[model samples]
Target: MIEIIAISEAHVESFHRALDTVARERRYLAFLEAPPLAATRSFVLDMIAQRNPQFVALSGGDVVGWCDVQRLSRPIHAHGGILGMGLLQPFRGQGLGTRLIRHTLDAARAAGMSRVELSVHENNANAIALYKKVGFVIEGLQRNANKIDGVYGNVILMALLF
Candidate 1:
């Protein structure tokens, strides 16, 4: 059975472990390499400390995925929330992604956000499909928006309006 729960201090270690696995297997670090294990641990703890909620999907007590609505993107984009979502590779085809994203959207609504946005690498087909499956539409594509391993990758800007 899979369960989604509010992130708590007790879950930090498990969350960190899950993140490392995602980072290693998915090569999802277009923006960040898996940091030192301790740093990754602290980063999540600090983000939670700032009051943005984090949730983990657990299957039989093992962390399988997580999604977070990083609060308050910036001064100009204060009304918008940014997201970082991931699941273990083996868990990809199941409906876990849908459940995780829906949970984040509900959190965004509760936070009074009128809009939510995320940038996906243009090449990440599964993520694009999942985002579209959850009602996020592509707003635009940012050309040469990010450098990954010395190659420029376009970022597809996706949004969901509440």
Candidate 2:
């Protein structure tokens, strides 16, 4: 069974440790064919300190995924927020991604956010499909938004209005 829970300081070190050698390696490879990611650990830790939510997906007591929800500028964009998430490759295609997004949506609504936005690389068909399944629609495409292996990659900006 999978479970979702709010991350705490107690989980910070392990979370960072798990991600340090794994997520960074994959993302770096995707972006630059590199094997290390600089500053990602510190960034995640700082986000936790700022009380930006870090949710963990667990199965049998092992962390399998995570999603973040943070508030956006107010007044002009009141009740708006941003979301970012990822699941281990082994955990993908099992509907866990949908559950993770739904958890973030619920949390965002409870925190007074009426809209959520996210971006996915155009090359990531699976992620785009999952987001669409959860009601996120592509609002626009940012041209040459990312450079992977010296090639420009586009980003699909998507949003879900609550």
Candidate 3:
């Protein structure tokens, strides 16, 4: 069974592990590669201390996925948040991402966000499908948004409005 809950400092280590696993794959996610564990810990600490919520999917006490909704810090853009998320390889195709995104949207609404936005690599069909299933609409596309291994990729910008 998988449980979804807010991320805490106690979960930092596991979160970093899960992130590392996902980062090794170049098909999805915004990060070109994994950040160091110490950087991951500092990020988790800042999020938890600020009470800015990020949710995790757990199974057997291991972090299998994470959904992060980070509010725009600029005063004018603070009514919305940008989302980023990923699930472990084993958890894909199990509807876990849809579940995590649904929960993340709920959290965004509760946090008084007027909308949530995300960017998916244009080639990631599964992720784009899940985002659309969760009410995100394609807003625009950023050409040559990411370059990895000398290959440039585009990204589709999507958003869910409350």
Model 1 Cα displacement at 126 (Å)?
1.4
Output the number of the TM-score-best candidate. 3
Q: What is candidate 3's lDDT per residue for 30-149, written digit by digit as tens?
A: 675669888999988887775566999999999999998888889999998899999999899999998898887888898899989989899999999998988899999999989988
Computed on alpha carbons, the lDDT of every model, listed in order, comes to 0.80, 0.72, 0.89
Best by lDDT: 3
TM-score of each: 0.85, 0.80, 0.95
Q: Which stretches of candidate 1 lie over 4 Å from their true place?
A: 73-76
- Backbone clash pairs for candidate 1 read none
Residue-by-residue lDDT tens digits, candidate 1, 19-137: 77777653454435357767867767776776665788987787889888877757777777888888878888899989998997898788778788888989889899999988899
Q: Write the per-residue lDDT of candidate 2 for residues 10-36, one digit (tens) a residue.
A: 565555555554445444223322123
The lowest-lDDT stretch of 10 consecutive residues in candidate 2 is 28-37
Per-residue lDDT of 113 in model 1: 80
